[model samples]
Target: MSTHPTTARPMDGTARAAELTARTAAGAAELTRRTGTAPCLATVLVGEDPASVTYVRMKVRRCELNGIRSRQVVLPAGTTTDRLVEVVSGLSADPEVHGILLQHPVGAHIDERAAFEAIAPGKDVDGVTMHSFAAMGFGLPGFVSCTPGGIMRLLDAYGVDPAGRHAVVVGRSAILGRPAGMLLLARDATVTYCHSRTVDLPARVAEADIVVAAVGRPELIRGEWIKPGAVVVDAGYNPGNVGDVDFAGAAARASLITPVPGGVGPMTVAVLLEQTVRAAAVQLGEDPAALGL
Candidate 1:
């Protein structure tokens, strides 16, 4: 392995996210001017987990910054799966709502998939439904899970081509890991998924040209495993703001790496706002690209 001190360049997501958000804000402003309807995102939080609450608050704040309206529905912890579905379905049917986000990890008794499926496909800007997953996998036009979608955008911003590259994604959760791998695969990257059960995880990771750490285990992917000149996208956000990859260690070998807080996090909200604007434009029969989105 080439051991020259990693010429790793920081992929400054904060700067890129700000640029995208500004673009989205401009598009939203134009759309509102033409249609007299501001783009709106409806957020449904099932319980009051502190982290989830904080995340929702951040999203709402970003919406405000982008000139988008936000509608919040806070449900009790004791809410049943059926009731949760009812609530989300109501938001899905609301004509004024352009995008729907259901905060994840609802009560254990609630059927998460059932609740996610209740969202209308058009309003599934969070990309939790089967339709959205299929759309992303097939490279069709549809909303994507914010984090994965944001990762793709980050790659685009940095001009990293996924075509014919080996990408190893750690973790297989529906929202982050699985979709991330699918999205990379759709872009023609050879993809492999490693979870807690995978054998010889380090060896598998060392073979990758691109590594996406989304397993949510802090420092689970050690620095030694990072290939020289690889691009590392650490998508994990654990307690204490730690990511799955050892930042310092991985950076020593990576050509590009994303920092935990400033990396994938900001991009997620930016993509959500951008997609909400697109959804609104579609609903209004306006071309989002023509609005310079």
Candidate 2:
């Protein structure tokens, strides 16, 4: 029903992410120059899921490139929830650590929420805490869950206005889908959340002006279900690097669509690093505004 062009434009997330990362690096360098303290991100990973390990490695590498320091904490798969919480709490208490990121899907037996709460709100750069979720919902200035924050950034970069738009977020995971909808709602978009239990999922998705495919199932959101000219933000990174949306089919119908590897993934890291620099500035008593926060 939309009048926008059917010839879709690929949103160049890689380029935008690079631009933001460069800016963050510059800001980090300046902050370090002023305070003699580089921004530090402490990453905690429980049970080495290969994907999680690779993600953490990528984050650490980006930190190095951006002049931020990374401290790695690796726990065995059998570690208890309490031990994990203690480790995160220890990092939170360390004044030298400016930010904390506990990688997702920390072993099946561990209480993820309890472990996440161990991170101090100020240092939760990954934005997994209840406090961060509240702040995001209220449109307050606080750290956001990285992927959702990155999606917002992508929307802005592409000149997509979210106000009054009907946005369908197709997942409800604590970190990805839920927060993404909240962020969209904060920007004045009308948001509907859909999951496995939702009735007639395709019908619901077709009604959206903006579609965010965050469900882990690859190609779950078929291209035919995309409203013509709608903006599609694919946040899923399934095995084989496929996104939740059928990229080929959706790209034909969407006015703007993100490609799998080059889209949301890069931006996630960029936002994380950017927030780490900001956290450092705040913790060091340096004015974040002065660093172009």
Best by lDDT: 2
Clashing pairs in 1: none
Expressed as tens digits, the lDDT of each residue in 1-293 for candidate 1 is 24455768889899999999999999999999999999999999987999899989999999998889999999999999989999999988899999999999888999999999999998888888999999988999999999999999999999999999999999999999999999999999999999999999999999999999999899999999998989999999888989999999999899999998899989998999998999999988999999997
- TM-score, every prediction: 0.98, 0.98
Local accuracy by lDDT, each model? 0.93, 0.94
How well does candidate 2 match the true structure in TM-score terms?
Answer: 0.98
For residue 199, give model 1's deviation from the true position in Å. 0.6
The 10-residue segment of model 2 with minimum total lDDT is 1-10
Number of backbone clashes in candidate 1? 0
What lDDT does candidate 2 reach at residue 61?
95
Question: What are the per-model numbers of colliding residue pairs?
Answer: 0, 0
